[model samples]
Target chain A: MNRETAFNLVLAAVLLAAPVIAFAANEPFYVALATRIAILALAAAGLNLALGFGGLVSFGHAAFFGIGGYVAGIFASHAMYSEPLPFGLPATDQMPVIWLVAALLCALAALPIGAISLRTTGVYFIMITLAFAQMIYYFAISWPAYGGEDGLSIPVRNSFVGLNTANALHFFLICYAVLMAALALTWRIRDSRFGMALQAARQNEVRLAAVGIRPFRIRLTAFVLSAVLTGLAGALFADLNRFASPSMMSWHMSGELIVLVILGGTGRLFGPVAGAILYVLLEYALGGMTERWQLFLGLILLGVVLFARGGVVGLVAGKARYD
Target chain B: MTEPVIEIHNLAKSFGGLRATDDVSLTLRRGEIHALIGPNGAGKSTLIHQICGTLMPDSGSIRLLGQDITTLDAAARAQLGLGRTFQISSLAPDFSVLRNVMLAVQGRQRSSFRFFGNVMADRSLTDPAMKALSQVGLETRAAIPASELSHGERRQLEIAIALALGSKALLLDEPMAGMGKDGSRALTDLLDVLRRDTPILLVEHDMDAVFALADRISVLVYGRIVASGSVAEIRENPEVRAAYLGARP
Candidate 1:
C-alpha cells in the first residue's frame, strides 16, 4: 500500500480504538470528545472537496451546516409537540431520516448559491460565500421559531434502530461509522472520472474548457456535493450536543472548517481527520491554560501556511505522487 | 478533393478602434495542411481565436463539418470537434501525462460525469489516450507528471490531447515556438504525417517548418491576407516576399 493509504489505515484504527478504550476505561467524556473529532472531520472533508479538489474557496459553508442542524432540531421539536410541519408533514426523530432530509435540503440550497457564487472567483468568491452565510445566520437569529439566538435543545437524542444512542460510546460509534462511510465516498470520488475533471478545473480552467468540459458546471457540481456532506455532519453534530444553535451557522464556524482542512492537509484523504484531532486536542488543552487560546492557534496556522504548505498529512506521508 | 472540414467567411474582429482581424477568411480541407504565416501583430492569433470560438467575430460565419458554429462558445465549439492547442502550453500541470490525454478522451466521449468508476483502470479511456500518446511517440512518458516534461514534450502532449479529442480539424498555435532545430524538425515530420487524416490550420512563425509542410499557404499582413496560393506561388510572389519572407533573416 502507498504511504497515504498506510497512514489513513493507522489513523482510522487509532480513532476506532480511542472510543473503545474510553468505554473500557469508563471515560465517557473522552468518547464524546472522539465523537466531536469524527463529526468535525466529516464536515471538513466536505469543504475539502470544494476547497482542495475543486479550488472553490467557499466562506459560506456554515449555511449548509446550519441548515442540517436546524433540520434535526425542527424535526425533533415537532415530534416532541406532536405537531405536523407547515406542509402537514409528520415529524420524525430517526437518525437516518433526519440525515436524508438534511442532505436533500442542503443540496437544494447549494444549487442556487453555487450557481450565483461560481461566477466570481478567488477572494470575490470567498466574500460572496461569506456574505451568503451571514444572511442565513441573521435570518436564523431573527426568526425565533426555534428559540432564535438561544437555540433548540433535544430533550432526547434522536433514535437509531438497534442502537442505544443515549450512551456516549454508542453515539461515538455511530458518528465514527458515518464518518468512515463519507470518507470512503470521498476516496471513490478522488479517483473517478468526475474527480479528474474537478482537479483539472482547479489546476487549469482554460485547458478544461478547451477539452470541452465546462469548468463552471464541474465546480458547481462539486460545490453542491460538498455542501451535502457538510450538512450531514451538521445533523450529527447537533444530535451529539443535544442542541442546535444559530452559532452553528456563524461565519466563525465556516472559518473553523477551512482551518481544519488546511491543518490536516488539503486534498489528502485522511487530512481532515488528522486535522480535527489536532484541533480539538489543542483547543481542549490550550483552553484549559488560558482563555485567549485562539492567539496560539493563529500563530500555528501561520506556521503551517508559511512552512508546511502541505499541512500535517503532507509532513507525515510526503507529497502525493500525482499532486 | 474532400469537402473543407472548416470554412471561415468574412471574419472580422476589432479591439476599440484598431481592427485586429478585418475580413479574414480561411479553409481547411481534408488531407491538406493550411499554413497561416505572418509577422507578429498581424492578427493571426485573433483570426485563430474567432475560428476556435474564443473571440466572437463582429460579422462572419464559421462552418465546421458544414455546420455554422460562429455563435458558439469555446467549449461548445470544442464539443463540436474543433480542437486547438494554445500558443502557450496550457495543461493540467499536476496530472500525469496519461491522465491529461485521458481527460481529452473523456471529453470526446462526454462521460466526465461518471463518479464511481476508477478512471485509471477504465480501458475505454486509457486505450484511446494510450493510442494518441503513441501516435505522438509519448506513450513511454505517460506515467510522469506533465509539469516535469521538457518544453518539446509539452508540445507533443498538447498534440496528443488534440488527437485524443478525435478532432475533425486542428488549430495549432505556434507549435514550435521554443524548440531546437532537431525539435522543430521532429515536429515538422509529425505534422506532415498527421495531415494525412486530420486537416490542420497551422499558425507558425517558423518559416522552414511552414514552407516544408504547408499544402496551401496564406500570408497575413496587418490584419489582411496579403497573398494566398501554393507554396511555390507564394515563394514567387514579390509582394508576399517584400511584405513578410524577404524581410525575415
Candidate 2:
C-alpha cells in the first residue's frame, strides 16, 4: 500500500483501540495509569520539539516541568484554604488560570537559559543546561517554605470551567484529550514555515546563516516554546497526583525524558508516546517481579540505543523522516 | 558609475608573527566576475575568510554597496545579500537534497519560532526550493539524500544553495575543485549563466576556466595584489607574467 493509505489505517486502528485497552484493564486504575502515560508523553513530546527536531539536547526540562507542578500545587493549597497568594491575588483553584501561570513561568525562565545556553553547541550546551537545572534542583531542595524535600500536597484537584476535576476517570479523559490535541498541534508546527527554518537551522547552522537566518534566535524561540508545552504537562501531572516535589526537578527526571525520546525513536511523532507506554509498562512489570529491576532496565536501555536505530514506532509503524 | 559591491582598503591581518593579508585593497564591481588566483600558501583562503566575515582583519575597512560592513558577522553580511559557498564541507548529508535547498530558502523567510505539524505544507518553502533545485539541474533528484549525490552534483547543489540564499553576489571559493573534464564544463556553464545577474568572486585553481570566465583577474603572490586588469591585459603584462605565470614557467 501507499504511504498515505498505510498512515490512515494505522491512525484509525490506534484511535479505535485506545478506549478498548483502557476499559479492559478496569475502572479507575487502568484509566489513571493511562492518564499518567499521557501526561508523561506530553512532557516528553515538548522536549522532542527541541531535542528531536532542533537538536537541542537540553537536560533541564524537568526543572520547567517541576516549576509547572509547583504552580498548581501552590495555587491549590492557598485556594482550598481561602488564603491570599504572595501577590495578593486570591488563590485560584481554576485550572485554566493555573495552566496560564505555569506556561508563562516556564517561558520566562527559558529566555535567559536559552540566551546563555545557545551561545554554545553540542556538548557544551548539554552540560550547561544540565548545570542550570542542577542549580534550581538544589535550591528547591533547600527552600523549606513549601515542605522542601518532602514537597507540598494539594487537598483537592484544580477545577475546570464547567466540570469537576475531582473525579479520577473524568480527569483521565481531560488529560488524554489535551495530550492528543498537543500532538496534533505539534504535527502542524513541524510542517509550517517556522518549523522549516528551525529544522534547517538544526541541519546546518552555517548554511542557515549564509541564507540570512540567525541560528541563535531560531533556537532560542524553539527552546522557550518547547519549555512552555512541557510546563503545561507538568501542571496537569501535579493536579493528577495532588502533589509537587523536588524529585520532579531532579536530574534523573531530565534523564528519563531524554531516555523516553530515544527509546521511542528520537525524531518520530509518536516516539514520546511509545516510549512512555513501554517505559511505564516495564516499570510496572519489573517492579512487581523484583527490587533490582532497574539494573535490568539499564540493560534494555543499552540494547535500544546500540542495537535499535529506530524505536518502537519504527518497529510497528515504519520509518518516519520528519521526527 | 554604479558603486562597487565590495571594497577593501588597507586591509591587514596578522596571526601573531605572520602577516596573512598585508595592506590589501581591491574592489568588486557590479556585474563583473572578479577572480583571485595565487599558489599554495599565498593566503587566498585567508583573504576570502576575511571578506566573508569569518575572521576580522587586524586593520582595515570593508564596504558593501558603499556601506561600511567590516564589523558585521557572517549572518549579518548574508542578510545584506552577500552569499557564500564553503570550499571543503557540504550541507547536512543525512537530509534529502530538496531538504538542503528548502532549508536555505526557509532561512530567508521564516522566524524559526515555529512548532507543531508538517513543515511540508508551507508553499513558500517549496516554491523557491524547487526553483533552486531547477537552477542546479537537480530537480529530478530532489528526493534523494545529499550524501547520496555524486561529488559533482554536490558542487552544483552548493551553487543552487547560494542561489536560494537570494544574494545578489556569490563568493565561491573554488567551484572547479576536484571535478573531472565534464564536471568542470558543467560548472563553467553554470557560472557563465549565473553572471547574467549576480556578480561572482571566483577563487579558482583552474587557469583555463579562469581565463575563460573572468572579466578581470587579480594576482596575489604574497598577500599583495601584484596585478589587476582585464584578463587579456594580464596575459600580456610582463609584471603579471613575472609574478604568477613565470612561477609556472
Candidate 3:
C-alpha cells in the first residue's frame, strides 16, 4: 500500500487500540478522551462534505449540531420524568430511536437554512449561514423549557441494545464504529455520481447547469446530508457529557469544526480524524501547560494555512492521487 | 428545409442605459453550424447568453425543439437538450477528464441522487464518458485532472463533455479562442463532423474556422444583426465588410 493508505490505516488502528488499552489500564478518562476524538472527527467529517467537497463554507453547522444535542437532551429528560413528549409520542431513551429523531430533526432544520443561505455565494454564504446559527443560538438561550444557557443534564446515559453504555469502553467502541462508518460514507460519497456533481457545483455551477444538473439542489442535498451526520455526532456528544446547552450551538463550535476540517485536510477522507486527534491532544497538552492555549493553537493554525497547505494528512500522505 | 431547432424572436436585453441585445432574432437550423461573429463588445456573448438562458431578455421568446423556453433557467434549458461551453474554459478542475465527462453522461441518465454506487466502478457512466472522450481525441488523458490538461485539450474536453450529455444543440462560445493554428484546424474538423448530429450556435472570433465551418453566418454590430447570409453573400455585404470583416483579409 502507499504511504498515505498506510498512514490512514495506522491512524485508525491507533484510535481503536488506544481506547482498548486505556480501558484495560482502568483509565476511564483516557477512554473518554478517545471517544471525544471519534465524535469530533465525525462532526468535522460532516462539515467537510459541504466545505471541502461541495465548496460551501457553511459557518453555522453548530446549529445542526446543537439541534442534535437538544433532541437527545429533551428526549432523555422526558423519559427521566416519565412525561409524554409532544404529538403524543413518548420520550425514548433507545439510542437507535434517538439517532433517528436527531437525523430527521437535522434534515428538517437544514432544509430551510440551506434554501435561504444557498441563494448567496462566497462571503455572503458564510455570513448568512452564521447568521442562521446565531439566530438558533439566541433562541436556545432564551427558551427556558430545557435549561437554556445553563443547559440540561441527562440523569442517565441512553441505552444501546442491552449494552452497558455507562461503561466508558462500551461507549467508546460505539463512537469508534460510527466514526469508521462515517468515514466510509464520506469515501463512498467522494466517488459517487452525486459527489461528482457536488464537486462540479463547487468548481463551476455554470458548467454544472450547462450539463443539466441544478447546482442548488445538489448542494442543498449535500448540506442536509452533512447536517445529518454532524447531528448524529452531536447526539453522541450530548450523551458523552450528559449535558446539552447553548454552548453546543454557539458560533465558536461552528468555527472549531471548520478549523478541524482544515487542520487535517479539507477534502481528504482521514483528514478530519487526524485533525481531531491533533486538536484534542493540543487542547489537553497546551491547556495543561498554560491558560492561554488558544494563542499557541492560533500560531499552529497560521502555520498550517500558510506553510502546510494540504494539512496534516496532506503533509504525510502527499498530494491526493484523485484530485 | 428542416425546422430550426432553436428559434429566438425579438430578443432584447439592456444593461442600464446600454442595449446589449437589441431586438435581435436568429435561428439555428437542424444539422447546421450557424456562426455568430462580430467585433469585440458587439453583444455576441450577450445574445448567446440570452439564448442559453444565462441572461434573460427584456423582451422576446426562445423556442427549443418547438417548446417556448424563454422563461426557463439555464439548468432547465439544458435539460431540454441544450449544451454549452464557455469562452473561459469552465470545468471541474479537481475532477479527472473521465469523471468530468462522466458527470455529463450521468446528467443524461437517471437522477444524480444515487448515493450508494461507486461511480468509478459503474460501467454505464464510464463507458459512455470514455466513448465521448474518444470522439474528442481525449481518451488517452482520461485519468488526468481537468486543470492539468493544456489549454487546447481543455477545449477538446469541453466538446467531449457536451457530447456525453447527448446534446441536441450546442452553444459554443469562442471554442477556438486560445488554440494554435493546428489546434484550431483540428477543432474545426471536429465541428465539421459534429454538426451532422447536433446543430451548433457558434460564437467565435476565429474568422478562418468560422468561414470553414459555418453553414450560415450572422454578423452582429452594436447588438443588432447587421447582416445574415451564406459565406459568399456575407463576404459581399458592404455593412459586414465595413464593421467586422474589414479587419481580416
DockQ of 3: 0.73
DockQ numbers for every candidate? 0.77, 0.59, 0.73
* Order of candidate numbers by lDDT, starting with the best: 1, 3, 2
Provide the lDDT at A106 for model 1. 97
In model 3, what is the error at residue B226, expressed in angstroms?
A: 1.0
The weakest ten consecutive residues by lDDT in model 2 chain A span: A7-16
lDDT for each residue of candidate 1 in B1-249, tens digit (9 for 90 to 100): 666899889888889998988788888899899999988899998898888777889997899999999999888888989889999999999899999999999998898888898898899999999999999999999999999999999999999999999998999999999999999999999999999989999999998998999999999998999889899998888888888877442
Reported per model, the fraction of native interface contacts reproduced equals 0.82, 0.65, 0.78
What are the per-residue Cα lDDT tens digits for candidate 3 across A232-258?
999999999999888989999999999
Candidate 3 regions exceeding 4 Å error are: B247-249
How many Å off is the CA of A309 in candidate 1? 1.1
What TM-scores do the predictions have? 0.98, 0.93, 0.98
Order the numbered candidates by TM-score, best leading.
1, 3, 2
Highest TM-score against the true fold, candidate: 1
Candidate 1 lDDT, A1-323, residue by residue in tens = 88888989999999999989998999998999999999999999999999988989999999999999999888888888889876999888889999999999999999999999999999999999999999999999998888898998988889899999999988999999999999999889989999999999999999998989999998999999999999999999999998999999999999999999999999888999999999999999999999999999999999999999888899989887663
**Model 2 stretches astray by more than 4 angstroms:** A1-25, B110-119, B233-249
